[model samples]
Target: MDVTVNGQLTQVPFGLSVADLVRGRLPDPRSVAVAVNGAVVRAGDWERTQVGPGDAVEIVTARQGG
Candidate 1:
């Protein structure tokens, strides 16, 4: 299936959960916060959160500052 991840279009395997996409595929998953289709998803919910075509996903990570 095709979905928009962090504003970029990408293809992922069917039946993949948010947790799988973030932890298994996406680089540096631990440092980022994820939102699916405009709703912020909690870490505990990732396993049950399923992604589909045209879904908009946002991933933001924290950065160290002086």
Candidate 2:
């Protein structure tokens, strides 16, 4: 299936959950926030949130500064 990740178009396997994507891409899942289709998804809900074609996904991670 095709979905947009951080404003970029990408293809991912079917039945891939938000948790799976975060865990696969980020070294620390606890430091990131996810939003799917304009809705902010809590960390606990990532396992239940599934990505589909044309879905908009935004992943933001915390960065150290100052």
lDDT of 1 by residue, 1-66 (tens): 899998889999888899898886567777778899999999889999999878998878878998
Clashes of 1: 0
How accurate locally, in lDDT, is each candidate? Answer: 0.87, 0.93
Q: What is the lDDT of residue 1 in candidate 1?
A: 88
Model 2 TM-score on a 0 to 1 scale:
0.93
Q: What lDDT, from 0 to 1, does candidate 2 have?
A: 0.93
TM-score of each: 0.85, 0.93
How well is each residue in 1-66 modelled by candidate 2, as lDDT tens digits? 899999999999999999998988897887899999999999999999999989999999988999
Tell me the lDDT of model 1 at 54.
85
Can you tell me which runs of candidate 1 are displaced by over 4 Å?
A: 25-28
